[model samples]
Target: MAGSGDAAKEYIAGSAAGVAQVVVGHPFDTVKVKLQAHNTKAHRKLYKNASHCTSRILVEEGIRGLYKGASSSFVGIALESSLFFGTYAHAKQLLQGKYEDGKPQLQVIIPSAACSGALISCILTPTELIKCRMQVQGKDAMHATWYSSPLDCAVKTLQSEGVRGIFRGGLATLFREAIGNAFFFCSYEYSRYWMHSYTDSPRFAGNSNLILAKDVGIGIISGGISGMAFWTTTLPLDVAKTIIQTDPSPLSSRNPLRVLSMVYRRAGLAGCYAGLGPTLARAFPANAAAIVAWEYSAKVLGIRGS
Candidate 1:
């Protein structure tokens, strides 16, 4: 009964934190997606850089443009975060049971996070496909008619391409989520563990009672590092995923690796990281706030991190 109650609390906390993360992060994400999907070789490039994209979005579409696909992102993130944190908690518990001291090492935590990430990727692919399609619209007349909103995008995709339409970038998403999250969770847990050791704080010494301020601070640091690690490790896959998801033509979206190869051939290595600036800019603060929000909310709900 107690374990079930704690799990419920953790789920709620994760959902709230996910909403908070999307609110803080979506604008930057919009810019990043646009830039990643932009065709630089065009006679008139849509955006020269991250700042240019931001300014153009402001001038052309107003503030609302910055949050074009926020509704979809909100829903997607809320579901993803709830599943991720809840799964991680349960996986940690299972690992603890396996260990003699009832405290799993980083090896256990890493695989747990990886598996959770893979599971979440199943849902995330379609969610992001809809969101990215909506976001790329409104940038120009060519794309403006592509989608009226996230819902319209999803509906159109269903009608045009069937159920498989929504999962355009599932392979890339799976790879990115699984591999990237492995690094992200490992970095976060290792950083927190190091902080506990370095500070020698009793609160961080055990899993039961962590100091709120210290934990939040460490979460911020860990989140930033993890964000960088994720992006660095999976930027190419992410770029491919974005391109595949945002492509308007049904036939063009068939092979992510083919698209990636074309991108590499056309633009070289740099092409694989088109929107890196905006992505990195968004990753740190956004993830920091998200991790802090998740940890803080969990604490408020009487769910301690193991």
Candidate 2:
């Protein structure tokens, strides 16, 4: 089991990594959410694709517009990541028992990841609801009441829908996080194992002197692969969650299946992946940076291993 010190280090590292991820990835995330929640019939279809979304935001709303809801995202990510990494570390330590050296086997890692993902979903649901709502506000003429900031959005949601409003899409978030993170953590651990054990990749070869560089490199590779795996597993559920979070009607937002069915009726299977392009585009680089930061920070703080 990890000592108290190790747990503290893991939390700090995860929070730091979350900050880095939010700073680099929030813009792409904004675009992705906007596209997913956008309604072609309701709006004029301002953006043709991910690239078009980027250009439109740049031209019309300037740099600030692309970073909508960044403040809430930053805090939410920090808390969620801290809890996730810390929980994963604790779970792994417990599952691995007396520690037989090397890695802790896939069986232990996978369950640990699932536990962490489920736990993080509690925080992620509310955070994402606010962020998505803020992101799509200006996209439609009907939602023209501009939220001055994340705080404003939170206050409005609370006043309008009570505490339940904050957790609008909690079930969908739980499903996505549990299933997606299982694949994500497995892919990352397996990728790192392959790089070090099979490929004899210099980036992950056993060398204490190069541990920092190796951890960061391994993290980048693992994170990229995990991002792809995560999105692939959970995109459809994610679409359901986004629709629920962004729907103006309280009744509509409560039923994820109904929203998903609406998406299918409106655009079929393709509609279920409305923002796939932007999401995949962001997934690799964003997750790469996030994991790199996470691993490197952990190492610097004296928490070691994959």
Candidate 3:
């Protein structure tokens, strides 16, 4: 009962983080996907930049346009985050063995985070496939007749492609999540550690209010920077993932490296980083909200870090 209770709390905290992340980041993500979908030389470029993309979406679809696949994202991110944090929490503890009191070793954190990411990729792949398709649907005249909603998109995809179609970009997603999350967790943990070391003092240990405020601030900063690191290093893989998932051609190669090569040949190196602007812009704030929500909720639920 005690173990299950802890797990439940971890899931709840993670779910809170996920919801906050989607609510804050979905608009930025929509723009990023739009940019990636049309960055190829094979298609005429649509928007000039992130600002242009934002205005175009507004003119065409209103404020709701920026949130095209939000419904699916809310569900997807919530479940993904729940499992992610829970799995990481448990994995870190297991890897810690008997020395559970100290800061986790880099070796321990890396593999644990990687495992969490790989596990969640199973959920993220399908969710992102729906999201990318929905985002790119009405971006051009050729694709102006968009699916009515995420459900419609999923149903139509199932009708045309089957379960395999739904998981079309599984390999790309797996690589992105596994690699990106390793950097993410490592950067976050190290950031927090350094920040705490630089600022923390034993004198303030008794002041719970001050400690709470400091912790939140650090979490926000650490999470934001970590998010940027994740995207900066992995955006190419993400661009490849988006193309693989959204390409209408059934025969399009699902291999990420091959897709990247195709992108490079068509649009040069710049093509591989299609949505660098909005992705970096969204990374900090979205991830900041996520970490803060996760840490705060965990504190509230009395779920201590391993």
Clashing residue pairs for model 1 = none
- Candidate 3 structure lDDT: 0.90
- Enumerate residue pairs that collide in model 2: none
Ten residues in a row with the worst lDDT in model 3?
A: 137-146
Query: What tens digits encode model 2's per-residue C-alpha lDDT throughout 147-259?
Result: 77889889988998899999999999998998898898888878888776764556645676576566667778889988889998898888899888887887775566776
Best by lDDT: 3
TM-scores of all candidate predictions against the true structure: 0.91, 0.91, 0.95
Name the runs in model 1 displaced over 4 angstroms: 40-44, 100-104, 201-211
Mind sharing the TM-score for model 3?
0.95
lDDT comparison, 1 vs 3, better candidate: 3
- lDDT tens per residue, model 3, 29-60: 99999999886656568789999999999998
Give one clash count per candidate, in the order shown.
0, 0, 0
What's the residue-level lDDT of 144 in candidate 2? 34
lDDT per residue for candidate 1 within 106-222, as digits (tens), equals 768888888889999998999999888877876464552467778888898899889988898999999899899888888887887787667655555555444656777788898
Q: Candidate 3 clashing pairs?
A: none
Off by over 4 Å in 2: 39-46, 98-104, 139-141, 199-212
